[model samples]
Target chain A: MLSIRDLVTSYGNIEALRGISLDAAEGEVTCLLGPNGAGKTTTLFTIAGILTAKSGAVVLNGEDMTRLRAAEVVSRGIALVPENRLVFPRMDVEDNLRAGAYSRRASAAEIAADVADMYRRFPRLEERKDQLAGTLSGGEQQMLAIARGLMARPRILLMDEPSIGLAPMIVAEIFDIIRELNREGVTILLVEQNARMALDVAHKFYLIEGGRITFSGSPGEIEQDEVIQRAYLGSRQG
Target chain B: MIDFIQNTVDGVMFGSSYALLAIGFTIVFGVMRRLNLAFGASIMLGAYMGTWLHVHYQVHVLVVAVTTVACTVLVGIYVERLCFHAVRRDAALASMVSSFVIWMQLEEAAIHLLPERTYAFPGLFAAGSYEAGPFLFRTEQTAMLLLAAVMVGALHLLLHRTRFGLALRATSENPLAAAYMGIHRTWTVLCAFVLMSLAGGVAGFAILATDQQITPFFGLWATFKGLIAMMLGGMGSLPGAILGGLLLGVVEAHALWYLGAEYRDLSAFLLLFAMLVSRPGGLLGQRILSREELAFRRV
Candidate 1:
């Protein structure tokens, strides 16, 4: 379980996350939905320790990790699959997976076993194990990014925009993967713009607007709200 | 024709030292994405440490060599802490200017220790030449070339076959993502500094021992040669560093033989200028990404 309490983070004078608080229970997909410039990505970054918070605390099951650096955050069992699927462009697929497990002290054999597991889950990666990650299709890159995060063997996986630019069919596939991961009991904190698909998989969802949480409910509750329907689902469902 | 071949042989032998120096620059630049202008000055100061020990205590050559490398690493750490680690990450220009300031400080420190224009450097081989067919090879230059090859090979293995290498390459490619993967950004940069300093110490020792002399100007000369060689081969590329150094050496050797000593440096600069004009990326530099790739990355 992860608890973020009144976290405030800023870039110079502009505050991206202004005292926003949220909770992600174990084995649940907690989704944060927001429009552009709504501080969704910033919240995830602060929790991952890539961006230092100006105040407040991030508690993982109890111990405070508010001041830990990014590496320390990963070692503490949080892995972030960053926005845009930022895989190492020049390294081969295998090497990229190896890099994902860098913070852990796993042996060569252990790591090889984990790599095999990843290849089994995503056979396309094994087929292109020797190819440069930069040349992979966008869908493949997204899969690699997810696999790379899983390589960390973290209890909490924070994925930012896993289906941003993929085709509709690919988006459905990604949502299926998310559901599969949640079923496997991997705690996920997802930031997404696709409210329909996100609601389909999210256990509990929160609506963030202008760096503040304005709504929180179950999928059924959100579907019945007129304002939520008009604001988020109107374009597609209409 | 024999003269040309002999000159090329000598050029390649001498170019080995430049290759070592350029490799140091490339490694540091590759990881940090910032230039350490004090690279040569730190090496010069380390070499000065060796010469001072030899001059004052009459120590063995092995001790002098070890002292040079150890001292260079120390000075290199100092530069990394003050000029790089202390500076903010986004302020790359500030770090460069800070390194330039440290270069001046190191130069003054070395001068204070020696207080002389030049001093004798202990040589590895006596005055002799080896005959291999028609070409003559100086004993010390051959030793220099062999040592350079060994060091480069060792460095290649270290980079391609280690966990540290994976972390380093990942950091170089994407610092933020590397962090997300749990790689320590500061520690990786610090280790790169140490690696570059070790190579630099060996290079300074090789060149000084071959020339059999040391001077204050060695700092400026080493920095310029290494920078030019790095730019020529391709910035942030290891193989490019080696090629650039060898090419610079061969060109300078021929120029010195044909057009007098004055044209040696002039010819080298001319070659650099032409290379920049024609291929700004250098011989093996990575080309700019395609527009489609760039657009995808942005999204």
Candidate 2:
């Protein structure tokens, strides 16, 4: 479980997230939906400790993790698949997976087993195990990024715009993967633009805009709500 | 023909040391995308520390060399912590300017400690030459060449065969993503400084052994030459650094032989200018991560 309370984050003179609060319950996918410049990415980054929050706290399983460094956050069983799937382009697919397990004190055999498990789950990665990650297709790179995050074996997986620029079929496959991951007990904090697809997988949803949580509800409630229908579904009549 | 062959061999032997220096210089640039201008000071530290150990403490030459390397690595860590790491997030330009200040302070320290314009460096190997067929080689020259080769080979292994190496390369390629994967950025940067300083220290030993002189000003000269070799080979390419140093030395040797000694320094610049014009990336340089790629983008 992850809890974010009154988080404020900024970049120089610009405030990206102002007094925003949200939560992702254990073994459930909590989706944050918003248009561009809504601080969705900023919230994930602050939770991951990549972007420092000026105020408030990030609590993971009741432990305060607000002051930890990015790597320290990873070590504490939280892994972030950043926006744009920033895999080390020069590194081989297998090596990138290994990097995800960097802070683990596991033996070489255990790490290799985890990598083998990843390969089994993502067969495409296994086919191009030795190939450079940068050479992969956009869909493949996104897969690699998710596989890499899973390599950490994190208790919580925070993904920012995983389906961005991906083809529809690939996006469907990514959502399927997300459902499978949640079934396996990996709590997810998902930031997405595709509200329809997100609502299908996410147990709970929060609509964010202008650096604040404008609405929060179950998928059923969100569907019936007129404000959500007008803003996200874009008027059924039109 | 024998004379030409002999001269070329000698040039390569000397060039091995230059290659070592360039390796030290370029690896830092590869990882951090910022020049540690105090690199030459690391070399100077090795020389001065080795001399001090030899003269005052009566340490064995081999022991002095090893200790000098250890000491320089510490100095390198100190430099990284104070000059580079402290202001790392501010701007790349900040680290660069801070390194210049560190280099000045290091140079000043060297001068204050030595005071003498030049001091003789005691040789580890005995003074003599060995004959192999028609070629005569100095014992020290062969040792320097062997040391450089071994060090470079070891460095190659470190970069490829170890987890630390993988983490370092990962961090260099993407610092933020590397952090997400649990690679400590500060530790990786510190590791790079340690490796580079070791290379510079060995290079300093080679310089002291081959030329048998140490001066505070030699730090500046060493930085200039190492940087030239790094550029000639390609900025962040390891193989390029080695090849660049060898090429520079060979060209200079030929220049001295044909055009006379006065044209020696001119030869290196000519080669660099030619490389810049023909291949701006250097011989082994790839445009994989350029200044644009490494630039800090404000979120």
- Per-residue alpha-carbon lDDT of candidate 1 for residues A174-200, written as tens digits (9 for 90 to 100): 899999989999999999999989988
Give lDDT: candidate 2, residue A69.
Answer: 83
Cα-based lDDT at residue A153, candidate 2: 87
Candidate-wise lDDT, in order? 0.92, 0.87
TM-score of chain A of each: 0.97, 0.96
Q: Please identify model 1 stretches exceeding 4 Å from their true place.
A: A235-238, B289-299
Candidate number of the best DockQ: 1
Relative to the real complex, the DockQ score for model 1 comes to: 0.85
By summed lDDT, the worst window of 10 consecutive residues in model 2 chain B runs over B290-299
Q: Pull out the clashing pairs in model 2.
A: none
Clashing residue pairs found in predicted model 1? none
Q: Model 1, range B76-167, lDDT digits (tens) per residue?
A: 99999999999999999999999999999998999999998699999877758989999889998888899899989999888777889999
Pick the TM-score winner. 1
lDDT of 2 by residue, A104-150 (tens): 76778998999999999999999999999999999999999999998
